[model samples]
Target: MKSWSSYLKQFAIAIGVVLLIILVMDYNIRLDELNRLNEKATIVRAQATQAIQTQVALQTQIAEATSDRVTEDNARNNGEIQEGDQRVVPIPATGVPPLEISVPTPVPTRVKKWQVWMELFFGE
Candidate 1:
């Protein structure tokens, strides 16, 4: 009977050691997971803060866009002349001719692929 009790005691001790090891491992895994979650929360908080700042900035821009000065500028850009306003076309100085857009003449030159490769590798 004494031997039976000793064997039982040994078995219980072994089971306790196994359970302790498992608990320690589970605790470590849980700690790692908690650290990951904390990191993710920090990232989310930063993103949320940035989003709020962006929202405020966009609201300010909207306010500015709707202001009287902005509206008048937009109207003027669209060629809308207000009351009591005279449209004056400014002419260049008498010596300077009006600027003319000259279309570039297309140079019709045919080159082979090998010539293009040679030009790319060397010089024009």
Candidate 2:
């Protein structure tokens, strides 16, 4: 009877040891999964932030496109003029265009270092 009880106790200890090992392996796997999920969440947040910024930029562009100034500029680009604005017709002059007078830049002559030293000593 003592031998039977001893065998049962040894069996229970063996089962406990195996269960402990399985639990430790499961905990490690769960920890690794949690880390992977956190990394993915970080990436998703960055993408969401970029998407929001793009949305804001698009909204700004939409607002600017609908403004009165932009509309007027577009109309002018399409050659539409407002009422009471006179269109001027320019005639090309047969005479020559006026000449621009520019002062000539003096050319600097480079001298040798020894010539410079000779000038410094004897150019008095």
Candidate 3:
């Protein structure tokens, strides 16, 4: 009877050990999945932020262009302005008339393949 009890105790311990191992493995898998989900969420948030910023910047540029056009129209209709005449604004202390300067379009920076991949995963 004593030998039977000893064997039963050992069997129970062995079963408990296996269950503990399985539980630990399951916990590790869950933790890994959680980490992956968090990383995906972070990437999505960064992309959204970049998109919003780009949209806002484009809107601001359009608004500025429209405002400039309106100002030019108003000046032309102000009665002091004549057709085919250039509006020369005097520069302070510079003996030179303020000229309308044409801004050149900026050249796009070259992107490396690896950089593009990183941007896709991590965003700018």
Candidate 4:
């Protein structure tokens, strides 16, 4: 009876040691997983901050684009004239009149059917 009890105690200690090793292994694996999750969270936070900055910049651009000054500048660029505004085209001080451009009429030449056939056969 004494030998049997001692053997049982040894078995229990072995089991306890195995369980402790498993617990340590599990703790290490969980710690590594937690580190990876923290890195991912930091990356997500940076991305969110960049998105917010981009949104603010876009909003500012929208406001500027819709402003009255920008509207008037765009209108002037598009050759729009406001009320009570006189548009004066500056003429050169030289008395020479602007030259007129004339397009020459293209003369059409008639081709004979026999010539066309000869040209096709000759590869010209």
lDDT of 1: 0.96
Query: Which stretches in model 4 have alpha-carbon errors above 4 Å?
Result: 93-124
lDDT of 2 at 90: 85
The all-Cα superposition gives candidate 4 an RMSD in Å to the true structure of 10.1
Q: RMSD (Cα, Å) of candidate 2?
A: 7.1
Between prediction 3 and prediction 4, the one with superior lDDT is 4
Q: What's the true lDDT of residue 52 in model 1?
A: 100
Number of the top TM-score candidate = 2
For model 4, state the Cα shift of residue 29 in Å: 0.5
Q: Across residues 1-124, which tens digit of lDDT does each residue of candidate 1 receive?
A: 5698899999999999999999999999999999999999999999999999999999999999999999999999998999999998887688878788999999999999999999899965
Task: Name the regions of candidate 1 deviating beyond 4 angstroms.
Answer: 84-124
Candidate 2 lDDT, 1-124, residue by residue in tens:
4698899999999999999999999999999999999999999999999999999999999999999999999999888899999977788677989688999999999989999999999998
Better of 2 and 3 by TM-score: 2
Inter-residue clash pairs, candidate 3 = none
> lDDT per prediction?
0.96, 0.96, 0.91, 0.96
**Candidate 1, after superposition: displacement of residue 58 in Å?**
0.9
